[model samples]
Target: MSQAAYIRDMMSDPASDLATGPSEVSSFYSNLNVLLTGGNGFLGRLLIERILRSCSGVNTLFLLLRAKKGKSSEDRFEELFDDVIFDRLKREKPGFAQKVRLIEGDVGQIGLGLAPEQRELLRATNVVIHGAATVRFDETLRTATNINVRGTKEMLRLAKEMPNLKAFVHISTAYSNCVREFIDEKFYPPPIDSDKLLNLVEILDDAPLQHLTPVLLGKYPNTYAFSKAVAEDVIRRNDHRLPVCVVRPSIVIATSKEPVAGWINNVYGATGIVVGAAVGLLRTLHCDPDMIADLIPADYVINNVIVAAWDLAEARNSNINNADSSKNPEIDEPPIYNVVSSCQKPITWGKFMQQIEDFGLQIPSMLCIWYYCFKLNKYEWVHKMYAIFLHLLPALIVDSVARIVGREPMLWKAYKKIHKFSAVISYFATQQWRFNNNGVLRLSAKLSPADQNQFELNMDKFSWSEYNYHFIRGLRVYIVKDPLHTGPKAVVRYARLRLAHYTLISVLCGIIFWLLWTLVRFMGI
Candidate 1:
């Protein structure tokens, strides 16, 4: 009933004062110090921005970054300002950047590669958000295991050291357990023991390890999901000392709201498919029309991450005061939240395709290659045939023309990459997964009313139609980085392409008809 009783018996954390109001939540974050991993990533950036913007009381954001591309972490931190996503923060609070401090460390390393002093400083952190991982589907087993699995292990090690740590939000994917059709808000056994895998990887050479990958993965799709699953198992087995929570978000796409609508950085996950089809590069995809497109806005996922941390913190604080461990033994197991849309705001692949087609016409890509046309089918064989006629053949013809003109033949390469992308993504597109999100809903209910509004993870409140429109527009601007002014030109180009396509079809049909007439005459029937 009331928030106080709900917290004590329900979550077993006696310190939850959130039953009182949003002020308590705010007061909790005020003057708090956070240790954040993967601060340079798309989701990481959103998390940092939300924390600074939502909780003004948050004092310091200590980012864990290693030297990348010959640049120090501090140098890369300066480059964050150049990103359009942070423009709002810069304009609103000129000194907002002051709150973020950099810690030089590599998660792939033992002990997180942090200096003794740096580790000591992190010991005072209030919360640790570990979101760093190698997300590539085709990544080598060694690289994937090192970054995704070993990296998480290091985060747990660091998290255990934080004396004031209230919660450790370990970001994972809903697809980690995709081997099954139904995934509940709980940890399933990993494919292999984390430590054993680590030791095995270290003992075997690169060639042997790569060869054994297929055997190691077994029913798993790729090393990314395989390693992430193992990483979760690692956290599950060793999460006793810290207040750990696993957040599994399914198919995260562009931002629906906040800072900017339709904001995205990379052409990964569903964004690649959406952008490729909208630009007329992708023609056909093998997907069951009825399969749920469990896509969530990046900002929505970020909201859940922030609120989850606060929820766990308030609960932990409440526990320290009253020490009611007997109330809920279920608390002995780590809390798992599945942040997915299928259970709340389900969008079928058929609906998503129509949305893309509709918005695609309105927001044509600035440099459409064909005419922004595509199709989706449930049959895998048909998809393969379409890939040949609609994809490979066309790519060959285009590349041949480029070769004749002495220009670089690139279309074939692009199509090859597209084929690989489709092959990998089709696993989810062609299948159905029923993820239960009752835990996520329960987590949201625990947030303060004010926090609930500011940190918006309510899927019931999400508008699929409206968000999909902005999502397409976001691909136009952010993913492709195209200027809005060029949309009109793209529209005209699309019109011309359509005319040429029709004319070519007419000529080919006439040629076929003439050949049939000649064949009949020769038969003399």
Candidate 2:
């Protein structure tokens, strides 16, 4: 179907273009100004596309962007459309750029680095979506505090200044409170006071702060989780007179539907493991095979975000209209929605690995240098043994050959980076978290059938097997830059690689058996 036809089918009733009513979520956003941060990030880009394509009545979208790599925000904004992710949006609404207004600013800076005029313009904003944060797991404590903690505080401060503000959605990770095994739809006590920690980072130098990171992180696994937890506390401690709520989505992956199926941009978190394994680099991972792999697609998260903002606005309107009605104590607190899959549709790491093997082999990438095989080791020692033999030894041999051929030796360095990534992700992979998503489910239940069809969050009917197939195919096509047309050639290459791999393994086993037999003969057995 054409992009225009797809939008018509998804957004409105097939009978007419005027099927959208005032009660619909799209109507709720009609003529409302929206302020969005982190418009260039993975989820951020999808959110922008969804809002523009679905919520067509939005007046103006103010994007807060920072200059990076010597490129101005304007340059970045124009270049954003250059990405194929926007191809569908561009075709659906070629005039979408007219509704977007760029604001040059940085979230990490004071007052969100907004100019006086920019602040004045944002006063008309009705919706604020704060999605900016330093996502690096190993980010320095100071930097993480500045972006995740302090930046969130600044956003809340700015939201208070908007007289017409209806909803403020702060995007966070589900692992923010991984220190606890069970997480509910409410706030927990932060590791440290947001103010005190921010002050310490501000007062100390880089060297001393580096030394203090571990102590400051406390029970948290890394700065990303630690700082995000504090940022939640920042929201809870504030007098939230505005319609503000927090959304915590677990390990976001590719787009399962909308815009395009299996579309992904970056290789973060579990995506790295998928790409590495698909290309025949990653052979082993230190993880529990039975542990729940709580992964949600990007479209699901964005859909939840849009619906959550609408829900918040509706609740606020209800409370105002029925002042004499008794208030639910739950509404007084900032609502937290843990948008995760394990609570509803659970898939194990073993099943996840099997899916990768199934789909990755079917549509193998031409970039594959070896056979597709992986081991999920429950013990760290076993994982290390496999890594040394399967990862390090092969990398060393490859680099040595490259050096002899007068080419730049890079395989060893690449393996070193891969090892670092695996170590950072080991904490989450080895354990499971039980998330209570009653709030998320309740919110979905509130939507009408039409609205639910437009903004899907219910995972009971979701298909992981189908999603996994598209996910592996996406990694090969999008992330690995291998086109789908090359699948036939790739399959031929993969078969040869698989044969060579088993032959080498059989030869090694035979040699080891002969050695054992010779030792026994030497001992006069």
Candidate 3:
């Protein structure tokens, strides 16, 4: 169907929009002036598109963007419209772009570095959605803290200044406090105080800080998780009077079922592993097959965020007049929703891996034969040995060649850098953490059946076999792109190489058997 037709179908029924969930209070859609941070990112882009098409009565959407290399915030907003993700919006309403206004600022700076006009836009905003954060797992502590922790602090401070702000939603990760095996719906502060860590980071130089990050993070997997955990604590402590909600989503993957099924834009999460395995780059994963793989789609996450915001706003408003009652209304705290899939449906790592291998082989290309053979016969020890040899021996050989050629050996250094980066992420892939998602289930149950169908987060609805097909398709169309469509070419090259390799091995085996027979005959046995 054309983009216009799709938009009409979605907007024709307001109840079908995933964002329009069941709420206790009526008329929650009136006069919503939303200020969304990270509006240029993948999830942010989808959220904005959904809101514009579904929520027609929204007053305005103020996008918080930082100035890029040579482009101003206005220039960036214009460029964002050119992306295909917004094609649906462009078709639905030619002037839909008018509702979105860009506010130039830096999240790391105070008041988000907004000027007078930008602050004016923020102050008038009714809802604030903070989605901007450094997602890099191996990012430096200084940079991560600056963007993740301090940036959130600045946004919260700005929210405090907004007189009409009804709800402030902070996007966080389910693995923020992943060091613990069982995570419940409660705030667990980090071992070290957030303010003290921020202070130490502010005074120390980059070199010394990088050296101390390992010791500082301690039991935490990486700096990303550590910083995000600290950021959540900061939000909880800062939101004493205002209504705030924290959404902690598990390892976010592609869209399960939405405007487009299995739609993914980035290759950072489990999608990366699937892509690597499809191309024969990843062979043996050090993980249990039975471990639960907690992955929630980006659109589903945004849906929950909107619902949580509305719920928090209503909850806060209800608590306002009851301050003098015997119940002590001040004790009513903000709810921290764990938006995960453990309760609804849990997928096993082994099943996911098997499906990816099958789907990669089914794609129409010359690569299919090799991928098929790799999955059937050569995927055991041979592929693992080959990976180790290619990853390790090349650097050693290159360094030797470089020494002979009278040049510095840089290949080994580059390999070390990549190895270090992979090591940090491998921990999560090799282990599993249990996040109790009773709160998400309870909240979801409160929604109407139509709302449940619109915002589908239940794992029982996902078919691993079908999803795997779209997963590969999404990788080709989005992650790898058209220019890199070399699956057919790779299949041919690997097939010929494998043929030569097996022939040589067979001939050597025959010669060894013949030699053993001759020795037995000569010994007159």
- Best-matching candidate per lDDT: 2
**Model 3: clashing residue pairs?**
none
Instruction: Rank candidates by TM-score, best first.
Output: 2, 1, 3
The prediction achieving the highest TM-score against the true structure is: 2
Q: Put down candidate 3 lDDT per residue, 138-239, tens digits, no spaces.
A: 788988898899999888888888898888889999999999988887789675777898898889998899889989999987889999999988877875
Give residue 294's error in model 2 in angstroms: 0.5
lDDT tens per residue, model 2, 366-413 = 899789778999999999999987888778767888989999999899
lDDT of 1: 0.82
Against the true structure, what is each candidate's TM-score? Answer: 0.92, 0.93, 0.82
Predicted structure 1: clash tally: 6
Winner on TM-score (1 vs 2): 2
For model 2, the superposed segments whose C-alpha errors exceed 4 Å read: 1-23, 503-525
The parts of candidate 3 lying over 4 Å away from their true place are 1-27, 69-71, 321-331, 364-386, 393-421, 483-525
